[model samples]
Target: MQEKFVINIGRQIGSGGRTVGELIARRLGVKLYDKELINLAAEESGLSPEIFEKADEKESKGLFPTLMGYLRAPFAGDDGGCTNVLSSEALFQIQSDVIRSVAARESCIFVGRCADYILREHPRAVSVFITADDACRIRRIRNRSGCTEEQARATMARIDAKRAAYYNYFSSRTWGVASTYHLCLNSSVLGEEGSADLILEFAARKLNTKF
Candidate 1:
């Protein structure tokens, strides 16, 4: 398709959502932004990338308290006030700007970090939610993370909770809800490649273009 469009994927932990996103981007010949977004946001905000990495997809303890801290001083005071004190909300805002900038410039696939919500008003954006059965997710997580089944399950719960909390805190929509996304797919049923193919077809149909 000559007309550029953005794909925003929201996925549960260990559901092969990233794999599907990478495959779709490869098939469409566009850049995929996941961890790359942190670098872009860090560059734009002039804050240490490590901070963004640590705060990625995590909700702040309390927005009011964090804003009060920011108001108290321009930077977050820690270790004699040398570090930048950007709250989770500040980091999200910076990343949202980067997402908007990228979408404005070209076609790309954005995985998580609420890209769907950030680009809600974009004329040619496709939002997808990728999920899988818990058993499937646990097995996938165990294989990828080299952890036991119990550890995998724990990891999944922890990460998904953080993502849900972050998404709910920042956006008006709820995370992993099918209605919040234009399309929802079960990655385990279709597998990564199949899911990517489906997304490409869906995107083409949504944009009324041939892929």
Candidate 2:
């Protein structure tokens, strides 16, 4: 109980992974690291946050956009040089450092951005994966995004592909696989509240903590 522990969550798009992570953090009275990580990584790297956000959960696609973005950065050199070249890989390393630094500092829940793999060697790291069936995921996405069924499906595919590509590129383990995580929950079956409760219980048991 002296040392702090961290919960790292990986979820499929529309699986309510973010919601579950928030719930766990609230119940544990700890901070949740999600989009907030982008801000931290931006500060850590001394680059614009927009570049990190744009590269979030994606692989390097091309050079032109990144190059153009560099010229637009306020800190960019007057010579229009790429002193701080930004790419998906570069952004990932920055985020990974932020993840490790924050995890070491406090007990928190990290949703996505490959936090599980980033903190793989942490003594008290708990990793989880949330997944749902196609119908369930599509329904959640439609409800949250107010998009048509086709649009929801498309969004799911796009986001899932990007997340998988990002995780697989940076992690030795594949994303969403049961063996890769300490616990894998079907959010569709458990629902958001139930999923959070189950994960909390799993973490308590895994870490031998009295939560």
Candidate 3:
């Protein structure tokens, strides 16, 4: 067997999660995969990249409430006699196949796309979730994307909503709910390098690998 560890990251947007994931991958000398998974999925599934991008990290249902997300199932029945909506099995299959292909090829760090859930069966796997305070996340998004604070906040809301629904729909676990991951780190507290160092140290202890 190839003796290597796989680190899968599920993170909130603007949490400096991607930067931390990249840093950990570099520290561990492992390949980092994020948006590349989209390309890989597209190629594997013969689906256009645009289609996958639209569905990526989003629930099949557009029904998540705009308020505090109490999701009243008001329109739950007889919408074209459809009973099962929000099904993501097709997307899940694509992600699962792509993740397995990557894992078979080499050990690496995979960020988002429910990679932890996709690769749940792998033996040498560590799953992490990263998040930050609303204010911190909004600031980071505004700075990175050059959006106004309101725009940043709105974008965060939409993206996080989609991610939550998609993750919950597929994984049978709540997103960022603390119980779904082996490590849950607040990037606001640790910052980028500090969070990276914490993950590196944890990995070192678990895998007996040197930084």
> Whose TM-score is greatest here?
1
How does each model score on TM-score? 0.91, 0.90, 0.83
The sequence of per-residue lDDT tens digits that candidate 3 reaches over residues 1-211 is 4486788888999999999989988877789998888889878865556656767888866532233111234344445343322224565677679988998779899998888887888877888899999999999998888999999989998999989998898888899987888889999998999999898788667666665
Model 1 stretches astray by more than 4 angstroms: 63-81
* CA lDDT of every candidate: 0.88, 0.85, 0.80
lDDT tens digits by residue: candidate 2, 1-211: 5579999999999889999999998998999999999899889877778878778888566622445544257565667654456666667777888999999899999999888888989999999999988899999988888999999989988999888887887786788889999999899897999999999898989998889
- Which RMSD values do the candidates have, in order? 2.7, 3.0, 8.0
lDDT of candidate 2 vs native?
0.85
Best first by lDDT, ranked: 1, 2, 3
What is the lDDT for 174 in model 2? 89
Q: lDDT by residue for model 1 over 1-211, one digit each (tens)?
A: 3877999999999889999999998888899999999999889876678878988888776632353444356455565444446677777888999999999999999999999999999999999999999998998888887899889988999999999998998996899999999999998888898999899999999999987
Instruction: Find the 10 residues in a row with the least total lDDT in model 3.
Output: 63-72
lDDT score, residue 157, model 1?
90
Instruction: List the candidates ranked by TM-score, beginning with the highest.
Output: 1, 2, 3
Tell me the deviation in Å of residue 158 in model 3: 1.4
Q: To one decimal, what is the Cα RMSD in angstroms of model 1 from the true structure? A: 2.7
| Top lDDT model | 1
1 against 3, candidate with superior lDDT: 1
